[model samples]
Target: MSLKIKKDLKKIRKYIDKIDIQLLNLISQRARCAKKVAKIKISKDPKTKFYSPDREAQVLRNIIRNNKGPLSNEEISRLFREIMSACLALEFPIKVAYMGPVGTFTQKAVIKHFGKSVISIPVKDVFNTIENKKYNYGVVPLENSTEGIVNNTLDSFIYSKLKICGEVILPIHQNLMIGKKNINKNIEKIYSHQQSFAQCRNWLNNNYPIAKRILVSSNAEASKIVKTESKSAAIAGDIAASYYSLKIIAKNIEDRINNYTRFLILSDKDVGPTGDDKTLLMLSIKNKIGSFYLLIEPFYRYKIEILRIINRPAPETNGVWNYIFFIEIKGHRKSKLLEKILKEVDMRGAEIKILGSYPEQLIRENKSNEE
Candidate 1:
């Protein structure tokens, strides 16, 4: 508003513009160097083993150690992730598939973990995505804080050949949405995917007991139904609301304030540690006494922390007599303890499959009072 303020603002704008230009130049130079390196590596090795975790980790450490800026370490890490992802794309594009019809929670989770630049292919079912190799990587929801485990997703892993390459936990915020034109009425019907409905069961039962609840294939599909039907409201996430241009009638309808969903990243190739890691495995033992206990005792003996275990009927056998056990543990296959456990399991002659080991999603501690 004043002459001095206006002059100061103009100076700041010029400085910011200069910084932007420097960043652009830096990124362009990096891209060109990466291209040359890729060409040389391809020609020399001919194996096309482009992904190097050690190299990536060194890059991140160098950036963090030398950082002297207003930007925090986390912000710098994210920026480099995008920059490196772009460089990797120049060498070869990464393919990712997730459960969907766009606006579904799985799509949001994939974007959160991989950023917006990834090639995200949507599939009808989680199994189909993994079994058919529809994409290089697949994401499937495994469990939720409020809903326990997604049985179908777990069961799919039992039969699928793909291994767990990584995992990400996404905080879920559910909303009661209605189309713009349908905002006036007390909606007679509500539509949502089964999981969505289950998550908000208590809230819906107490608030809208008389309304007819219809199950749909996905939250995005339910949002579409609501947009087409004036008398229907949909339970979905912010993405669905934005996609359908619906009004949020209510927010955070899940029973728990800290509702989150855990997703498994499936791929055929095994991923090693990214510092933090989680390993998944499926084991089948002979139908003899103490066979199951004998299989899992190695983990405990080796001091490995078991995070999850689920039992499913072996698909190969007709009867439920033989079962398969799925285990998620907090260690990498490269670790000495885990390697020992794997060896012990192998020596026992029990059918063991090392699904894969990958980086564990880091969760920021909640500072919100509501949680």
Candidate 2:
């Protein structure tokens, strides 16, 4: 408006434009370096994996630690992640498969970890897709803070040879949405994924008590159905609402305010440790007195922090109620202490299977708490 203000704005714009050129030059240099690295890897081994989860995790962690910014660490990390993602694409276009029709939480996790530059394929069956080598990586929901572990993921882990390469913790916010035609009409039916239904059970009971709830394969699917249906609403995330052009009737309908869903990045290659790592293992012990105790005693003896342990009914063999234990510990499987503990458990006559070690994503204030 004023001459002085106009002059000051022009000066600021000039500096910003100069900084933009510098940024462009730096990023281009980085991309060239990434391409060179890829060439070297290919020359060394034709089958080398271009994307390294361990290296990426370490780089992100280092970025966060060194960040002294006006922008939050998260914001800075996200900017760097996209830059890295683009550079990696220059190296080799990475393809990832996720449980999706798109707009699902698993897709969101894939994007969050790999960035939008990756080629993320929507697949009805993520496990099979990855196992068949259709995609280099796959993502699936592992557990939720409110609903606990996803049984399907556990079952897949029991049989699938794919390894857990990484993890992403996404804060879930369920919204009640409806199509344009149904916005004014009374919602007679609600659609959502089963886990979403469980997450927002109390909220739905209080707000839409008489509405008939329908379960679908995914929240995205529910949104897709509700987009054309009158007198119907869908419980889904913001992404689904945007994708389907649905209007939100209610936001954050989940009963828990701090709800989070942890998704696992599955791949054929094993990820090396990043010091702060979590290891998952499956164990089958004899169905006898103190068998469980013997299996768990090594963890306590070796001072390993047991993050979680879930017991599932093993296959019914000869009418016996045998159980399998899924245990998550704080240290990586490569650690000597952990190797020693695994040997001890194996020597105790328990069948132990190391699922994988991945960089720890979710940090709890109190490790004992259920989050």
Instruction: Give the winner by lDDT.
Output: 2
Q: Which residue runs does candidate 2 get wrong by more than 4 Å?
A: 183-185, 362-371
lDDT of 2 at 234: 93
User: Pairs clashing in candidate 2?
Assistant: none
Worst 10 residues of 2 by lDDT: 362-371
Candidate 1 local lDDT, 1-371, one digit each (tens) = 99999999999999999999999999999989888888999999875646554356557767888989797766776688788878878876777788879888898777766666677778877667666765667888988888888888877766577877767777787899998668586699999988889889999999899999999899999998888678889999998888778888998898777788888877767775766678888888877889888889988886789998988777666554788888889978888888888888988878887877877654432414112
lDDT of each: 0.80, 0.89
lDDT of 2 by residue, 117-217 (tens): 99999998888998898889999998999999888889887788888988888888889999988857679999999999999999989988999999998
- For model 1 the local lDDT of residue 6 reads 100
Q: After superposition, how far is residue 37 of candidate 1 from its true place, in Å?
A: 4.1
- Clash number by candidate, in order: 0, 0
